[model samples]
Target: MPLVHIDLIEGRNDSQIKGLVEDVTNAIVKNTGAPAEHVHIVLNEMKKDRYSVSGKLKSEEDQ
Candidate 1:
């Protein structure tokens, strides 16, 4: 089994998230020989105010 965890600031639509997971699953399957059904993905979407980099919150960065 292959497990993948992805974290991002919340903004993308459902289709975008679906595409991201599909792409990630394909990559894992291709590289590790894992079955697509056996690949597990966890997506953690954080609010812009809850995520930060270099002392700047994502929401602040956007302003």
Candidate 2:
């Protein structure tokens, strides 16, 4: 089994997120010889205000 964890600022639509998981699963299966059914993915969507870089919050950057 292969486990993947992805974290991103919230905003993307459901289809986009689904596509991401599909692509990631394919990549893991190709590289690790894991079955697609055995691949596990966890997505964590954080609010922009909760995620920051270089002392600037992502929500603040949009302003």
Candidate 3:
């Protein structure tokens, strides 16, 4: 069994997210020779306040 974890800022619509997941799964299947059914993909979305950069939260960066 193969697992994939992806983290991103929370905002994409369902269509976009679905496409992302599908593409990731396909890539995994193609590169690792893992069956589509056996490949696992996980997506984790966080709010701007939960993500930080350069010692500042994403929400604070725009200020």
Candidate 4:
């Protein structure tokens, strides 16, 4: 079994996350010889205010 964790800023739509999970699972199956059903992917979405970079919080205004 393979456990994969991915953290990203919140806001992705369901379809995007679904596709990402599928792709990641497939990659693990191909590279680590793990069965698709044995691969696990956990996604953690963080709020913009909860994340900081260069001493600044990530926000829409930062763009």
Candidate 5:
């Protein structure tokens, strides 16, 4: 089985997230010849406060 893990800030709607997982799974299947059913995808959505850049928290921005 092939496992793909993705982490992103929490904001995207359900459809966008679903598309991401599907796209990744399709790419893995096409390139690695892995079965769709055997592919494992994990999507981790973190709160803005849990992420940061340049020593500043993401939630501090005008998101």
Candidate 6:
């Protein structure tokens, strides 16, 4: 079994997130020979204000 964790901002639509999971699962299956049923993908969405970069919150203009 292979587990993949993806974290990003919390604004993606359902279709986009579904496609992302499909693509990432495909990649894992292709590269590691993992079975589709054995591949697990977890997506974590965070609010912009909860994320930070360069000592500034992601909601800030600098992000």
Q: Against the true structure, whose lDDT is highest?
A: 2
- Choose 4 or 6, whichever is better by lDDT: 6
Badly placed stretches (over 4 Å) of model 6 are none
TM-score of each: 0.94, 0.96, 0.89, 0.91, 0.94, 0.91
Tell me, what's the RMSD of every candidate? 0.8, 0.6, 1.1, 1.5, 1.0, 1.8
lDDT tens string, model 6, 1-63? 999999999989999999999999999999999899999999999999999889988889644
Q: How would you encode candidate 2's per-residue C-alpha lDDT over 2-47 as one tens digit per residue?
A: 8899999999999999899999999999999999999999999999
lDDT of 5 by residue, 1-63 (tens): 998888999999989998998899999999999899999998889999999999999999966
**What TM-score does structure 1 among the candidates reach?**
0.94
Write candidate 4's Cα lDDT for 1-63 as tens digits.
799999999999999999999999988988989889999888899999999888888984568
Please give, for residues 1-63, the per-residue lDDT of candidate 3 as tens digits. 889899999989999999998998899899999899998888899999999988889998678
- The TM-score leader among the candidates is 2
- Residue 9 of model 1 has an lDDT of 82
Off by over 4 Å in 4: 60-63
Compared to the true structure, candidate 6 yields what TM-score?
Answer: 0.91
Off by over 4 Å in 3: none
lDDT of every model, 2 decimals = 0.93, 0.95, 0.92, 0.90, 0.93, 0.93
- Residue 21 lDDT, candidate 3, scale 0-100: 85
Candidate 2 colliding pairs: none
Tally clashes: model 4: 0
Greater TM-score among 5 and 6 belongs to 5
